[model samples]
Target: MPHDHPMTVDAMLKQEFWEALYQRDDRIWSGNVNVNLQTEVEGLKPGRALDLGCGEGGDAIWLARHGWTVDGADISTTALARAEAAGREAGVTVDWLHRDILSWRPEDAYDLVSAQYMHLPPALRRDVFTAAAAAIRPGGSLLVVGHSPKAMRQFDGQKPPEELFFEPEEITGYLGDAWQWLVETCETRGEGHHTDAVYRARRLEA
Candidate 1:
């Protein structure tokens, strides 16, 4: 009966992996805005922001404090709970939605949509990133950061699946001609070994 569950096997695996990780620690990610996100967003005017795969609300809280109305979404209920608590602790309000990025459909466009280190199987990654792109309002910005394929060697003994890695182009290429690329590059961090592919683009007015 378990094997014949309603959810697809891939969905089950994705949930299991993230849930187990969240359970293993009080927090799986640092309670700080990702460096790339902070850097990329520093100059942009704040507005309605959507944070995809937002783990623990660090970035969302940061955006809220900087005058943006933030909506943070993640698949893991545990992570969403922590994110809500973090938002409270920061004295900022973030709309925390427990939803998988791969299947999410935004009801409204946002001035900024950010997905930091949102790695998934290639198919899922393309789908979610494309959707995120589409959710950006004209003249709005989209920022995506992911583990670059080059970082695979930095995993020590517990290497992630190769398919979870992506190049910046893979994400940027998903956008249509309406987007103007801003930042597209890879950068190393943390002992100069862990590299991330960072992409930032702005949608043109129709």
Candidate 2:
């Protein structure tokens, strides 16, 4: 069993925290897609995509390389800068934005809007999840990811214990009648560092 520790968002976003975490020689969380994200989104064609909480730009950069016009957003300037540098190095163009998603407003609709591993307090999670669902154009999709309930004990990083993790049913509850569920599942990855519930839903045409 892991040590019981207090968890908070403020504790998670300390300066140089995530950068130091990702900049390691091994690329522990470097911007790469593990099995979960790729398997779920493999059929998605390159198009307008919003990568929320896009740390180090791995997934966003990958989408761009595959032909998506991606806007990668993160609250960390350091992470965004590193992602920009990585994009340049990879010869891919990705728009990096340093903004908090809590206050972010969509200027235009997108074909795909993704929030991977965004663990917000209950209220904020609902707000953003709803907003993301609404931000999709007709026939567009919303992809949300968060650690699974079982992940609490296994994955050791920042997120609260599995008790605080939201399940796919909880997420679908938020969608209500606005969108149709395309996919939803809970899985483990990353040598036990990641246990996540993935949600993929498409807005129904009016």
Tens-digit per-residue lDDT, 111-160, candidate 2? 88888878777777887777777677867778877776666643454445
Q: For all candidates, what are the clash counts?
A: 0, 1
State the lDDT of candidate 1 residue by residue for 1-206, as single tens digits. Answer: 12223333364447665676677778877889888899989898989999998878889999999999999998888889999998899999999998867787887899999999887887878788888888888778889887777777633244557788787777666775533544444344442347778888888776
The positional error of residue 45 in candidate 2, measured at the CA in angstroms, is 2.7
Report RMSD for candidate 1: 4.5
**Candidate 2 clash total?**
1
Report the C-alpha displacement of residue 70, candidate 1, in angstroms. Answer: 0.3
By lDDT, the best candidate is 1
Indicate which candidate wins on TM-score: 1
Which residue segments of model 2 deviate by more than 4 Å?
A: 1-6, 13-28, 154-164, 179-194
TM-score (all chains, Cα) for each model: 0.86, 0.80
- State the lDDT at 23 in candidate 1: 77
Error of 1 at 161 (Å): 1.2
